[model samples]
Target: MPRFAANLSMMFNEVPFLDRFASARAAGFEGVEFLFPYEFPADELRKRLNGEGLTQALFNLPPGDWAKGERGMASLPGRQQEFRDSVKKALDYAATLNCRLLHCMAGLVPAEVSLTTATSVYAANLAWAAEQAVPAGVKLVIEPINHRDMPGYFLNTQAQGADIIAAIGSDRIGLQFDVYHVQVTEGDITKRMERYMPVIAHMQIADVPARNEPGTGEIGWSYVFHRMDELNYQGWVGCEYRPAGDTVAGLSWRERFAR
Candidate 1:
C-alpha cells in the first residue's frame, strides 16, 4: 500500500500546527504535509515533527497574497530574482524540517504574459531551484492547480507539466501530481498517473464532485489506489482533502484502508 500522509493544513483545524503533528501521529499517519511553514519558527516545527516521529513529506514554497489577489509568480517572467530569493528561503526552511520535497508554486498566469514565455521562465526556475534542492537531497516539485478551483492559475494540464519537466531534464525536479486537481482538469486519473509516473515525484488525493473524503465523492479511489499498488509506487500518498465536516468526524472512511 502507498504510505499515507495527512495534509495538516486542510484537515487539522482544531489545533495549532505543532499540536496537529501529535494528532496526526495519534490518528495513525506516518507522515504529514502542509501549505506554508513560514508562519512558525522553523526550528520549533522541526522539533515537533521529530518529537512526533512524523516525516515532512511535502509543503509549498511561499506564494504571496492570495487574499489580496496576488498568487505565486515562480513561472512569470522578469521575476527570476524574486523566485530565486523565495527558493533560497524555502530551502533554509526545508532544511530545518529535514524535508525531501518542496512544491514550487506556478502562481497566476498573467493575461499579458505569453504562454511560451511563462513556460520558459518556469523551466528556468525549476532548474535553479533543483540546483539548490538537489544538494540537500530535496526534490523540487511543480504542481498544476485546476482553473476551476484557482482562476488565473498557470499550468493546469498534465501534458503541460510533463513537458516542462522534460524540458528541464533534471532528476531533482519533477511534478507534484495532485490527483484531485488533475481529475478535475484532465479527467483520466489512472491513465494520466501512469503516463506521468516517471516524472512525478509526489502525489496527493481528494475525492471529486465535492473535494470531500475518499469514497464520499465520484472518483473511484479504490481503482486509483489499486493502480498505484500495481505500479509498486513506493512514495507518499497525501490525503489532501477538505473535510466535509469536522476532520475527525469524517474519518470513518479510513476504516476501509485499515483493513
Candidate 2:
C-alpha cells in the first residue's frame, strides 16, 4: 500500500500547529507534510517530528509574501535573488528536519511578462536551485496547479512539469503529482500518472469539485490507489485536502478507498 502523509496545514486543524504532529501520529499517519515551516524555528519543528516519530514527507520553499498573494517567485523575472535566498533558507530547514522533497511553486505570471521570458527565468532559476540542493540530499519538485484554483499560474500540465524535469536533470528535481489539480485541469488521471510516474518524486491527493477526502467526490479512489501500486510508486502521498467535517471522522476514506 502507498504511504499517506497528513498535511498538517490542512488536516488536524482542530489543534495548534505544533500539536498537529501528535494528532497525526495518533491518527495512524507515519509521515507528515505542511505548506511551509518558516514561521517556527527549525529545531522546534524537528523536536515535534522527533517527539511524534513522524517522517517529514514534503514542504515548499518559501513563497514570497504569501499574505500579499504572491504564490511563489521561482518563475518571476525580478525576484531571482529573492528566490535564491528563499531556497537557501528552505535547505537549512530541510537539513534540520531531514526532509528529502521540496515543492517549488511556479508563481502567477504577470500580464506584462511574456511566457517566453517567464519560462526562461523559471528554467534558469530551477537549474540554479537544483545545483544547490544536490549536496543537501534534497530533491526539488514542481506542481502544475489548476488555473481555476490559481489563475495565471505559470505551470499547469504534467507535460510541462515533465519537460522541465527532463531539461533540468531528474536527479535534482521531479514532479509533484496532485490528483486534485490534475482532475481539475485535465482528466485521464491514471494515464497521466502512468506516463509521468518515472519522473514523479511525490504525490498528493484530494477529490475533485470539493477537494475533500477520497470517496467524497468524483474520483475513483480504488482505481487510483490500485494504479499507484501497479506503477510501483514508492513515494509519499500527501493528504493535501480540507476535511468535509471533523478531520478524524472523515478519515474513514483511508479504510474505504486505500485498502
**Best lDDT among the predictions, by candidate number:** 2
TM-score of each: 0.95, 0.99
Candidate 1 lowest-lDDT run of ten: 250-259
lDDT of each: 0.85, 0.96
Question: What is the C-alpha lDDT profile of model 1 across 1-259, one tens digit per residue?
Answer: 7788999988878887668999889888899999889989999999889898999998988787757876686888888888888898888988899899999888898899998888788777888888888898888888889989888888799898888778777487788888899989989999998988999889998988788888788888767888988877778988999899888877777667423
Relative to the unseen true structure, what is the C-alpha lDDT of residue 43 in candidate 2, on a scale of 0 to 100? 100
Runs of candidate 2 with Cα error greater than 4 angstroms are none
lDDT of 2 by residue, 1-259 (tens): 8999999999988999999999999999999999999999999999999999999999999999999999999999999999999999999999999999999988999999999999999999999999999998999999999989999999999999999999999999999999999999998999999999999999999998989989889999999999999999999999999999999999999998888
| TM-score, predicted candidate 2 vs. hidden true structure | 0.99
**Model 2: which residue pairs collide?**
none
